[model samples]
Every structure is written in structure tokens, then in C-alpha cells.
Target chain A: MISKKKVIAVGAIALAAVLTVSGCTSRTDSSSGGSTAAAGAGDAKITVAFVPKLQGIPYFEAMNAGGKKAAEELGITWLYQGPTTADAAAQADIVRSYIQQNVSALIVAPNDPDSMAPLLKEAADKGIKVLTADTDAPDSVREVFVNQASVEGIGEALTDQLMTAMGGKGKYAIVSCGETAANLNAWIAVQKAYTASKYPDATLVNVVYAGEDQAAATSMATDLMNANPDLTGLVGECTSSAPGVAQAVKDAGKTGTVFTDGLGTPQSMAPYLKDGSSSASILWDVQNLGYLAAWAGDQLATGKTLAATNDVNADLKGIAYDSSSKVLLLGDPLVITKDNVDTFSY
Target chain B: MTLDERTKPAPQSGRPAGSSTATAKRILPLPVTGQEFVLIGVLIVLWILLGIFTPAFLTPNSIQPLLVSVAPIALIGVGMTFIIITAGIDVSVGGAIMLCAVIVAKTMVSVDIPLIGAVALAIVVGLVLGVVNGVLIAYGRVAAIIITFGTANIFQFLALRVFGSSTVNGIPSTLEVFGRGEAGRTLGVPNSFAIMIVIAAVAWWYLRHASGGRHLFAIGGNANAARLVGIKVQPRLLVAYALTGALVGLGACFILASGTATLDQSVGSGKELQVIAAVVIGGTSILGGRGSVIGTVLGAILVQTVTSGVTQLGWPSQLANLFVGIFIIIAVGTDLLRERARRKA
Candidate 1:
């Protein structure tokens, strides 16, 4: 009995020792994996990985679809993943895994730009080409930013479209997602300034944050309308809240009375646009934007500098790339009304 | 405690049991509890203040939508109050709602199911999830939070897999009868909120007057002691969790109705926190000895009021979170103090 017990103890120790040795080796191996790949053969497929703010949402999925298409056309491996929620730490984990996998190029639409700077630097140091797409990490060591539309582009479009519906507007409020989202805040800033400059009669009454919640956006839009009885317009500032604001107007039995235009996907905004609750959805072609990001990542990976004007494809022609600031510009934001909503499925 | 000792009225009843022949005289508690009274008072003060500040706040347009928003949370809170009463918590309702909403939304679009059929499907799916949670926690002897937290992630993954990486668009508005639209109202009251009130009333009575209800209190107070006295602890816990799942299914339908025509992956995001916040603020003890469904109903109303009031008053929407957090702390603080005082006495 004592001999059997000793054998069991010895076996357990052997197993623990074996596991400890293997774990240490794998740890060192992964750390060195990135460096070796950066210096290794050119025969392998050029891998481009893009991580969005969140996965499974229509906006990002369309981007993923575009990225996949670009991968097929360019003959490179396109790896796409993101945190299920637009959470920074979770995004960072996925980014780190991609970095370890030694993907040739890494792209991120960071949820938190400030926190992502160091991680981007770490990837850069490992010799992996790094870039930002959709949402930029301005202070990071990224080589390029694949921008879909300028802050002025979306903001002016939203304001202009809603003003047209409101007949140059009376009072408007903005329902935005993510209180601290950099891009949304920039757009809101532009909306505030543009509304003030362009339309003398239109007033920006309030801007509320709904934190990527469609239902909260709807309820808040209702409250905004109630708060300002004469309020004629609302801008749903994110994909989720875009339809949300329109739903609020419809539910309140004030469809034509209150005009809403937001950054909504076409399919989601189709119902509202047809019903006349929402005037227009101002957004760039999301899938095309994704395709551009993957293409840019490959360009950076291959050490090919983008020209001032480059033809990407038939759908994406004469795309502008600013060499000094490293920003790749996808042209004007597309406005989706009832007439054009069905044309773009994503 | 012996069977003789256990047969006596629970301390929560606030009176000795079997002391008189008249069953009316042995009524467990007053129709309302102290926490509920306080909640009612706070709600009144806030409403009056909101009415004064925002002239349109008291109108049907504003109030009707507010009630519509509160319906789902309170409806789910009824089941949550039951689970908390049995010393259990289900934080997976958010994920459960996501799965149920997506499934129902997909079903409604593809199968063109009617309102009754849609609702029934959601409830059954939710019940199955609840049973999965209940069976693992109740019989497996795992902590409720640990099990529910793990299941929450699992449910989210399943929901995401079902989504297949796209939003469920063009959802038919057949469920609009429970929405905030014109069809969702009856005689000036929102149909969804009215239904929630009826359900809450039934729950309030059951928790206060039923034998099964008292057994839940006993089990929560001490599961082993209750088991010794012949209360089926595991089954009781199972029933509590399963009941919550069923309510979550219905709540998801209300949520879908209240939302836009498109259903996205974010459909039920952060909803568990909202429902849990409402339940705790409604004066249900987190530790699980004493609570009321009325308090939960009122609590949901109060939370929604604060959210709507903050927006109507043109205050930064983040202030609503701060106010709800303060309310939860105060409710739990007061509960702890009361518990301490009771023990000392």
C-alpha cells in the first residue's frame, strides 16, 4: 500500500514537471514567433488581420465581408475578429493574440484610443505593420489610418438631411452612443458647429449618450421631444441608435413631425425610411471601407507606399492617401433614403 | 429546529403563527412593506418635481412611453424577486434575453408566427435556459453567481452563433400590440405596462400568502434547516430559476416590441444590470430573506422615471446611472441595518 502511494506521488510530480517545462518552452516560443516571421521567407501568404471595436454588429460584419472579399482578390490571408462587446480590454486581448500569431499586418478600430497606443507600439516593435481603421488611435505608432469619411462629411450630411426634412429645422437633439467615443464625439462637435454656422434658425438643444443601446436611444429621443415640444429633429449618432431615434419618432405618432437622420445601416434603416419616420441614413459603404482597410494593411505589409491618388477598384476609385499624416481617405459619406436604401444590403 | 418549531410562522411574517382560529388574523404582512412605501414616496416626489420642471413631462406622450419602457424590466423583476427571495440571483437574463429575442425575431421573420405563438416560443426557450441554470446550480451545489455567470457567457456565444454575423432586419410589427405605438395602448394605459401590473399583483399575493411562498423564505433563510423540515430545497430553487427564465422570455418580446424593426446582437446588452438594479432598489434583500414584487414594480418605475426625467430635464444622461447606484446602495444599506437590528432584538 505504501509503495503504491509513493508511485502515485512520483507520477504526479513527473506530470507536473513535464507540464512546467512545456509551458515555459511555449511561452518563449510565442515571444520569438513574431520576430522570426518578420525576418522569415517571402513564399508564405501575406496575412492581414483587422480587429473592429465590436464583432457581430451589422456595421462591423459588413466590414468583415468587405475584408474577406479583398483577401480573395489580393490573394492574402484576411483574419478578422473583435470583442463581442465594444470593450477595450477584450479588444486588446484579441489584438495581442493576432500580434502573437505573427500576422504580416495588424489593423485595429480601437474602442479606447489612449489605452491602445502602447499595444500598437508593441506590435510595431515586433516588426508587424500596424494601422488603424474605422476609428483611429491618433497617438499610436500606426503607419496609416483607413478613414471612411471625414468628421465634416458625416456631421454635415446628418445635419443637412435632417434640416431638409425639418425645412431648415427648429430645434434638434443628438442621441449618441459611447460617451467618450472619439469619432462620434468629433462628429458631434462638427454637428454643433455646422448647425450653428449653416442654419441660423436651427438650434442644437441637447446631446445625450445612450452607450450603444438602441432601446435607450429610442426612449431618450422620446424624452428629448417631450423636453422641447418644438423639437423637430434628432440625430442618432451611431449605427445602433440611428434606427433607435427613428423608432422613437414613429412610436410617438410623430413620424412626419419629427425628422431623424442617423448613421444607420441600410437594411436596419429601410423600414424607417419607407415609413417616413427617418429622412436619411448618412454612412459610408461599410463593406467597401473594410475592403480598403485590408488592402491598405497589405500595402503597408509589402512596404509599398500609397500614392496621393490610387485606384483601388471599380467601386473604390481615385481614393486619396495623405502621405505626411498617413491617412487614407475613402470618399464622401453615402446618404441612404427610401429610394437608395435597398441598393446597399449591408 | 424541530417540525414543531418549523411549523411556526416565519419571522418575516412579523407575527406568530397558529395563535388564532381566524386565518385573516394570521395574515403574513400588511398589503405593502416599509420599503415599498418609501419607494412610492420617492416616486411621487420625483414625478411632482419632473412635472414642475418639464411642463410636458406629465403628459400622455411622455408618461405613456416611460411606462412602456418600464414594462419589460418590471416584468422580469417579478421573477427576479422570486429568485432573490430564495437566496439566488440570475445575472444571465441579459444573455437569455439576447438568445430569446434573436430566436423569436428570426422565427417571426421566417415562420411568420403570430403574437401568441411568438411569445410562447420565447417563454419555452427561456424556461429551458433557466432549467439548465437551475439544474447545474441547484443539484450540482455550485454557487448561483458562478453558475449563472458562466451560463451568461455560454448563452451569449450561442446567441452570437445564431445571429450568424448579421442583424435580423425587417422584423414584422405584429408584436406591436405590446409596443409603445398606438396599437400598444388600451383606454389611455399602455398594454405592456398594464399586463406587467397584473402579473406583479399575482406575484405579490403568491409571495405573501401561499404555502410554497413561505417555504421559499424558509429555504432562503437556511436551506439545510428547511430541508430537515421537509421542504424540497433543490426543487424549490429549480422552480425559482425556471420561473425567472419564463419571465425573461416574455420580457424579451416586450424589449423587441419597444425597439426598432431590426434586431441586432446588442438587443439585450446591459439589461441584466437594469433588472437587477430595479429588483435591489425595490427593496428585495440581496441576501434573500425578505422582499416584495410590489417594491420591484415600483422600483422599475422609479429607475425608468429617473432615466426619463434626467433626459427630459436636459441633464446629462449619465446622471441616471449615478442616481440608480445611490438608490441601490441605500436600499442594501437599510436592509443590512434592519437585519442587524432584528438580530440584536
Candidate 2:
């Protein structure tokens, strides 16, 4: 009787396992086998694969869209996939899988740049075109870095936009995500130095970390406002917190009295921008960033050196590639407001 | 465990030995446990300290939003307390929340669902998912943790498919009556908090006085013995889980009302841990058969208070996590001692 019961239990577990596996078939298809571009492996066309920080997020999906568009226009095969969570080891495994597949080019927006550095070196050793985009691993032996925007570009823009709403003077606090996020910290440093130099009247009261959780950001933003009742400005240092701070301002009925800005996607920030809670959203053309990464990958695979200022597309013109630092600039960061919010689909 | 005392064949007549004597003498009829007093004391001290340290911490502007944030976690904790008392768990609640919130949010966007309709839709969806969990664990004779964990992944997969690579933007404000706005409150009390209190009070009475609720304790204590006493253990267990699911549905709507106009896929990530943490810290014995809905509500409030207090005090966010971890360990330690004392007596 015990054995019979055990068998039934085992069968139920196995059934659930099958159900879950079938449900995640799409994610598995991409991460395990790359994209449909992998079907043309034997074809003569160059295959440039871009692995994002993670999958199923609007940010990386937008980048993937741009990569696919580039592949169609440039006549190259663009493959895109990444881990489901923003995890380092899982991401390393995905990168390793692409390496073993021996794709023509592998571009990674590494979740952990240090751990990914060795993998990039190994891929470069295998003669696979290696490039980093959206983020960078400066110490790695990569051919080029497709930067979304410079730290100065993002930081100064955030400050300028918030200052515009705060009228260049008043106390503000920053609700940043991931205290140890290297990129966020870099941009914050720039915001501080630029604000001190340019908007000297504005005082940064405090900077708190709320992680990637939107609700936490909202509550923290509320706390910040309560902490500093006279505070007139706030900065949500990541996509999650961008809408979060704006929501807090609105919920507290401080929309007109206080202001918020952040690195938010157009769609997420549209309501806030329209309601006058958020002054502006600072972001780059994510699709164009993806296109540039794929374009750079193809250039490297075909042994072509990029011009200092290359015209990749009509929408993306005079893309600057600095050989000395191996950084390709996607020009100034695009400031998103209610006027242009509907223009971008994502 | 009073193992020797309860093993005397339950007297063949009077209340199944441990069911009455064990619950009444040691636990019930007191309305509140010793653990609850300690929890209340800790909350009082923390609030007083926070009020002193951060002057704004005691103000209405700060406390109102903090309670608004606490409403959902506390609301869900009421149901989680019932499930945990039955010695079963539903770790899939986070994934369940994600699925329910996205569905309700989508429906509201496409069809302009009213407040009652949106809430009704969420509860029904949550009920269906809960039923799936109930049937599998009760009938299949599987461990609750393993079953719920598996269902957790499946639920997330379905939710993400519904999301389809984009966030649900421009969600209508129809659900904002439960939000932190003026519409969400009545006579300075947030409607969501008031509603959670009413439900938790009902749950409290049902668990304390109702025969069906007492049967849950019996089942959690010993399923075989409860079955011998004609307690219908499987159905009681099923109700525990299904109840949690319905609460998860209501809680998801509360989460929606509190957030911004957009709902992302991260709507309910890591919430299971938070809910379980609230349950565990509420002095709910993981071993089963002992807990209170009131304690669980207080646990949720205490946890949110710690988080908001940290921010208001301008302390590092990691400190809030540290305090919560410490509270969990201490609560568990005290529960262990009490269980040992009960066994010896």
C-alpha cells in the first residue's frame, strides 16, 4: 500500500514538472537554443547574437526589437536571448552556451561585468566578435562598447530636468535602486557634481536605495517627502523607481508642489508626465542602442573598421566610435516628456 | 506534544482527548497568547522610539501611507495564518498575486470594470487557482511545500504569458478607492485597512469559537487521529488553502490600488516570502495546530512599520532587513520554548 501511494505521489510530481516545462517553452527555446537565426547557422550570412541582462522585461525586449530590425536591414542574422532573472551565474551559463555554439559574434550586456570578463576573453580567443552594450566591462578584452549614453549625459540630464521642475532651487532626495549597482552609482556621482556646479541652489538632502521593487520605491519616496516636508524635488534613479516616485508624489497630493524625474520608459512615465507629477524621463533610444550593438558586431565579424563618426541609420546618425577607449556613443540621452511620450511604442 | 496523554484511545467519547483539553487549557479561551503580548509590546516600543527619533514618523501624513502599504500584506496574512495553522502552506501566493493582479488590471483597462466587479473577478480567479492547489495536495498526499513551490513556477509562467512582453499601462483609477488618495479613506481611516480589520476580526472569531475552525487545529495536529474522530480532514485542509487564495485575490487588488498607473510583471515578486515571514513572526507554529489571525495582522503591520521607520529615520535600508531577520529568529525561538513547555506539562 505504501509503495502504491508513493507511485501516485511521484506521478503527480512528474505531471506538474511537465506542466511547468511546457509553460516555459518560449524562454527555454531562446535561452537554450538561441533565436530563429540559429536555424541559419550553416548559411553564409554572419550571425550576431545579443544576450540582454534578462528576458521578458520591457527594457531588454525593446533592445531585442531593435536587434531584429537591424538584422533585417543589414542582411545579417541577429540572435537574442538571456536569463529570466537578472542573475549572474545563470547569465554566465547562457553566455557559455552561445560560446559553445560558436556564433560568429557574441555581444553581452553583462549582469556581472567582472565574471563576464573571462568569458568574453575566451570568446575573443575563439575569434568570436565580442562587444558590450547598454553596460560595459572596461577591463575586458572587448572590441567595442555600445554605450546607451554617457554618465555625464544621463546625470546632467536628470538634474537639468528635475531642476527645471523645481525651478533650479529647493531640497531634493534621490530614491535610487540597487545601492551597489555600478552604473547607477556612476550616474549619481555625476548628478551630484553637476548639480553642485550648475544648480548650486538645489540641495541633495538624502539618497536612499529601494532596489527594483516599485512599491518599496513608492513608500520610500513617501517617507522621503515626510522626512523633508519642505523638499521640492525627487529623482527615481532607475526605471522601477521613476514611476514610483511620481506615484508617491501624486498619492501624497504634492504633484504641483513637488516634482520627480527618472530613467523611465516612455509608456510607464506617460501618465505621470501628463499629470505633472514627473517633469521628464531620461532615457536613450533603446532600439537604436540594440541596432548599434548588432551593427558593431557585424562590422567586427566581417573585419571592417568603423569610422570615427558612422551613419548607421537615418534615425541614428553620426554615431561616434572612439577607438582609444573602445566606446561607441549613441549620442545625447533622449528626454521623454508628455509631448513625445506617445511617439515611442515602448 | 502531550504524546503519552493523548494516546489513551481518546476515551472513545469525549472530544477526542487532545482536541478539547489541549486547545482549551493551554491555548484557547484567552483571546490572546503570550507571544501576542510580546509582539504588541515590541510594536509599541518601536513606534514610540520612531515617533521620537523621526518626528514625522508619528504624523498623519507619514502614518496614513504606511498603513495604506500595510493593508495588503496584513489582509493576506489573515488567510496565511489559517493555512499555516493547518500545517500547510501556500508559497505560490506571490505568483498567484502576479496572475490575479495582471488579469484584473487588464480587465479593468479593456472593459472598465467597476470596483466591485474588479474585486469579484480577482477573488474568483484566485479561488480557481487555490482549488487546483487544494485538490492536488489533499488528494495526491504530497507535501504542501513541494506542491505549492511547483505551482508557484507554473503560475508565474501563466502570468508572464498574459503580460506578453509589456507592462499594463494606464490602468484606470476605478480601483483607487482602496488607494492612499482621499477616496480610499473614511474618517481618517484607510478603507482597505478598515476592511482588512473587519475580515481579520471575522477570521479571529471563526478560528477561536467555530467547531469547523477547531477541526483545522485537530487535522494539523494529527490527520490520522482527526480522521478517526470523523473530522473530515481533507475538506478542512482544502478550505484552508482555498481561503488563502481568495484573500490573495483581494490583496492583489489592494496592491494595485496602492501603486502607480502602470502595473509591471514584478507586481508580486518575493511577496510569498514576505507573507510567510509575517506568518512565522506572528508566532504561528510551523509544526502546525497553533496560531492567531490577530497576531498575523500585527506581524504584517510590524514588518511594514519597520520598513517605513527605517526610511523615515534616514537609516540604511539593509538595517530594516536585519531587524526583521532578528525578529523572526527571536519569535521562532520563543515559540520553540513554549512548545517544549507544553509538551512537558
Highest lDDT among the candidates is held by which one?
Answer: 1
Q: After superposition, how far is residue A309 of candidate 1 from its true place, in Å?
A: 1.5
Estimate the overall C-alpha local distance difference test score of candidate 1: 0.88
TM-score against native, each model? 0.91, 0.92
Give the per-residue Cα lDDT of candidate 1 at A218.
93
Question: How would you encode candidate 1's per-residue C-alpha lDDT over B1-345 as one tens digit per residue?
Answer: 121132223444555443444564445666777777788989999999999999699999999999999999999999999989888888899999999999999999998788999999999999999999999989997767767877887798799889988999999997999998999999989999999999998888888888788888887787778999999899989989998999999999999999999998888888999999999999888878788899899999999999999999999989999999999998888887777666766
Question: What does each candidate score in C-alpha RMSD?
Answer: 6.8, 4.8
Q: Give the TM-score of chain B in candidate 2.
A: 0.92
* Total colliding residue pairs, candidate 1: 0
lDDT of 2 by residue, B205-292 (tens): 9998898989988887777889999998888888888888999999999999998888988899999989988888988887788888
Candidate 1 has a TM-score of: 0.91
Per residue, candidate 2 scores C-alpha lDDT tens digits across A1-48 of: 474366458757866775556445544566556645556567767999
